[model samples]
Target: MCKGLATLPATCLKSAKDIKHKISFLLQKPEPQAADQKQMKEKTAAAAAAAAKRVPTAAEVEKWKESFSHVMNSETGRTVFTSFLKSEFSEENIDFWLACEDYKKSTTSKLTTRAKQIYQQYVEADSPNEVNLDAATREETRQNVENACPSCFNEAQKMIYILMEKDSYRRFLNSKLIQDLSQTHSDTAQMKKKKNNCDCTENRQALAGGA
Candidate 1:
């Protein structure tokens, strides 16, 4: 049998080099077309515009600054907070919070699938994007997720939320960015008030002149 295998025709056997070359060929990606490149650029610009449009109003910022929960619950608050967190490389805190929010809403049928995904993405050790969790909490989360419980990550989520609340939230309130925005908002309001007063004064003068 060994001799028969060895004597098989040359066309019947692939050499090591040929197998490697085949794999390399199969893995090669095609170059993107000019149209695809243009589409990508347009998509990126649109996404940037959308993010800018989501900037919170001054009142909204003040509201969020009052409560950590408010910031987490509000989309505009989350966007602005996440931007600050990103600058500090701690955006994972809000990322985990949002993921937990979405995970909690998963339908029963999708619970297992979504739980596993969240665990691997944000809870698993050695995961690139894993969030901070104590060993005990991490172990508990691992066990809970094994059964796909709706609240599998509740403990871990709360830890991250508290971390952000105590740390990032304070920094956000005091940051130069927030201060500048607050000042700008005040200036804008003052300008609007002045414009309204000027318009009223002009109307009164016009009536007096007519009289």
Candidate 2:
């Protein structure tokens, strides 16, 4: 509903669009629509593990909150954050930033192909996932891409990273997904601690009887 946002200088409209996407993503059924309870549980667990990695430890999840770079550094953090960004339909920034990171590490042979794809997807004005960039920056990227090099998208990527660090990254830290993950890990830790205490109590009882 961020209407009339088809052109530049629509910062407010862009923010509205982001807000709309976040709301849409959050408004989901409490359970899978077509599945029975068992199926729902199985599917939910599998999907969560796939999207967020194997039940991220509380320590690991907390580490992500230390910085945007910290979140980007961990595989679990990246996977969860990317999924969140995609749900919000505002993934172009991180996606583009990641594409640039990959492009830089590409073998010489893959450089041109990766560069072309990155430009077509994120640099072109009408690209399916066009990132918000200014006229001067976009034009500069255009020239660099024509030549096809690893550094071609360096400037554009930096801008997108800043955009995300300022906007999306902040929202991500406060999102429900992160909250749920933190709670899940905390619960798991408590359950484990109780089990350990129970075992210790039984061991002490047995040792006292033996003595």
Candidate 3:
């Protein structure tokens, strides 16, 4: 029989029970098959990661130099540009612009909801993700929020666009992402040159054997 806790503060008994519960929980390990499945998942993920590391080709990287519009147009370019902007803590500009682009497609009935969301998210002074706009532009956007239409965010969007095109776009061209792409281009060119030389040597050896 368990001893009665004569109300002498059964704290020690409670502590002993808590320790027993923790030990039981710790001993309840995952089954062997569960462990094997987790290991399999990790290995599959590593394989996929290896496959996804392919470097962009020189032509693809060069297209970004054509214009700021080109970088925004290419999915890969946008990803790289976004990464650079994130590093600089200025990703909100592109984010707001993209949001406006998507917002433009909202149906007439959905315009008000989408407009208010965009305004609150990226236009208001106290918004969690507010974009940089002049006080006039911010006030103008706030006033425009009531009658929401497809073009509600037009002025604000244009400002952010120009901000990125003029400011961040130039910086991106000189950023480490661009520098890394340039290095990859050079490396690819060198590899092609070496391969061409090897092919020429093989052709010369074949001709000599024929003679």
Q: Which residue runs of candidate 1 sit more than 4 Å off their true CA positions?
A: 1-54
Task: Compare candidates 1 and 2 on TM-score and give the better one.
Answer: 1
lDDT of each: 0.66, 0.69, 0.68
Model 1, C-alpha of 154: deviation from truth (Å) = 0.7
TM-score of decoy 3 = 0.72
What lDDT tens digits, residue by residue, belong to model 3 across residues 103-158?
78767887887788778778999886789999999998988888887887899999
In terms of lDDT, the poorest run of 10 residues in model 3 is: 23-32
Give per-residue lDDT, candidate 1, residue 38: 38
**Candidate 2 residue 121 C-alpha distance from true site, Å:** 1.2
- Give the TM-score of each candidate: 0.70, 0.69, 0.72
Clashing pairs in 3: none
Residue range 151-194, candidate 2, lDDT tens digits: 88988988998888899989999988777666655555555666
Off by over 4 Å in 3: 1-55
| lDDT: the better of candidates 1 and 2 | 2
Error of 2 at 29 (Å): 20
